[model samples]
Target: MSNHKDEVEFPKMSFLLMAVTTGFVGGILWSLIGYLCYYFNYSTIEPNILLEPFTVGTWRESWIGIILTIILYGIISIGVALVYYILLKKLNTMWVGIGYGFVLFLVVFLILNPIFPSMKPFLQNDINTLIAAACVYILYGLFIGYSISYEHNEIKYFKEKELKR
Candidate 1:
C-alpha cells in the first residue's frame, strides 16, 4: 500500500518538474538560436547589419537583442504550455501538440508582422530572414511539443496505474 501511494505521488511530482524544466530549457534554446541567427546575419540584409540601425554602435545592441530574444522565447514557451494543456484537456495526442505549435507560429507570424512593419521589410522582403525565421520556429515548435507530450504521457501513465489499483 505504501509502495502504491509512493508510486502514485512520484509521477505527479515528476510530471510537474519535467514540464517546468522543459519550458525553461526550451526557452533558453530558442533564445540561443535567435541570437545565433542575429549574429550570423541570417536575419539581416547584410552580414553585420543587425547592429546597423542601433545607435550604441557596438555589439551592445546584441546584448539588448539577446534580452529581447529571451523574453520572446519565454512567451513562446508559455504559449506552448497553454496549447499542450488545452490539447490534454481535449484528450488529444502529441501530434495535436505539434499541430498546435505550427498553427500558433503561423498565426502569430501573420498577426505580428503586420503590426510591426519594420519586421516586414526584413522578413517578408528579405529571403534570408524569411528562411531563418521559418527554420527557427519549426525547431522551436518541434522541441516544445515533444517535451510537453512526454510530460503529458507520463502523467497519463501514472493516472492509468492509479486506476488499475
Candidate 2:
C-alpha cells in the first residue's frame, strides 16, 4: 500500500515561476544584446525601431525607449515561456530550443516585417544583420528552452533514480 499523502497530488508552482523568470531573463538579456549590437553597428535591427509601430511616430533616443523595449520583451517572453511549457516542455533537447529561436527570428524578420514600418523586409536586410539577429534569437531560445527542459527532466530523473534505489 502506498502512503495516502504521497499518492495525493498538489498543484506545482515552481516550474511555472521558473518559466516566468527564465522567460523574462531571456527576453531582457537578448533584447539588450540585440539593441547593443545595433548600437555598435553589428546589427541593423534595433528595439526602438521595432517598437515604433506601437508608439507615436517619433524617434526616441532616450534611455526611456531602451528601458521600455527591454521590459516589453520580458513581458512578451513570459507568454512565450508559457507556450513552450504547454507545448514543448516534454522535448528535452537543445536542438529544439535552437530551432525555436530560429523560428522566432524568421517570424520577426520575415513574417512580421510588414507590420512595422521601420523594419526592413527580409530581402532588404544584408547578410550580416540577419546573422547577428539570428544568433541573438538562438541564444535566447537556448536560454529559455534548455532551462525549462533541464528542470523538467532533472526532476523526473531524480524521481526515477530514487524509485530504482
Candidate 3:
C-alpha cells in the first residue's frame, strides 16, 4: 500500500499570486545582473532598453523610461513564470532550474534573435554582451524555478498544518 499522504489541493488564486510574486522577484534579479554586466562593461544593454525598445535612444536619459521598463520587465517575468507554472511545474529542482535557464538562453540568443527582425540587434551585439545576456537569462530562470518550487512546498506545508489542527 502507498504510504504517502493525500496530495494537498493548492488554491488556484493563491498559486497565481505566488507565481506573480516569484516572477517579479526574478525580474529584479535579472535587472541587478544586467546592471552588474553594464558596470563591468560586459554589456551596455538593460531591461529598460529591451522591454521598451521605443525608448532605446533615450532610455538611460530619463526616469520615465526606467519606470516603464521596470513595469514591462516585471510583466515579461510574470509571463515566463506562468509558462513554467503551467507547463513545467512537474519538473522542479535546482539543477533542473539551471537547465531551464540555459534553454531560455538558447531560445532568446539563437532562435528568436535570428528569426525576429526586432531581435536581430541583440544578436549583433558584442561577444561580451551576448555572454552577459545569457548569464542574466540563466539567473532569471534560476530564480523563477527555485521560487516556484519553494512556494509549492510552502503551500504543501501549510496544508499539512491545517490537517493536523
lDDT of 1 by residue, 20-109 (tens): 567667777866777788778897522223233443545535656556546655655775666565555343455655565566557656
The most accurate candidate by TM-score is 2
- Taking all chains together, the TM-score of candidate 3 against the true structure is 0.72
Tens digit of per-residue lDDT, candidate 3, span 48-113: 555443444654547766666666677788888988887766665887677788898887767665
Better of 2 and 3 by TM-score: 2
User: Per-residue lDDT of 48-136 in model 2, one digit per residue for the tens?
Assistant: 67577777744455788778888989999999888888889989999999999889889888788888886778988888898898999
Ten residues in a row with the worst lDDT in model 3?
47-56
**Clash count of each predicted structure:** 0, 0, 0
| Candidates ranked, most accurate by lDDT first | 2, 3, 1
Error of 1 at 20 (Å): 4.7
On lDDT, the leading prediction is: 2
Give the C-alpha lDDT of model 1: 0.61
Instruction: For model 1, name the residue pairs that clash.
Output: none
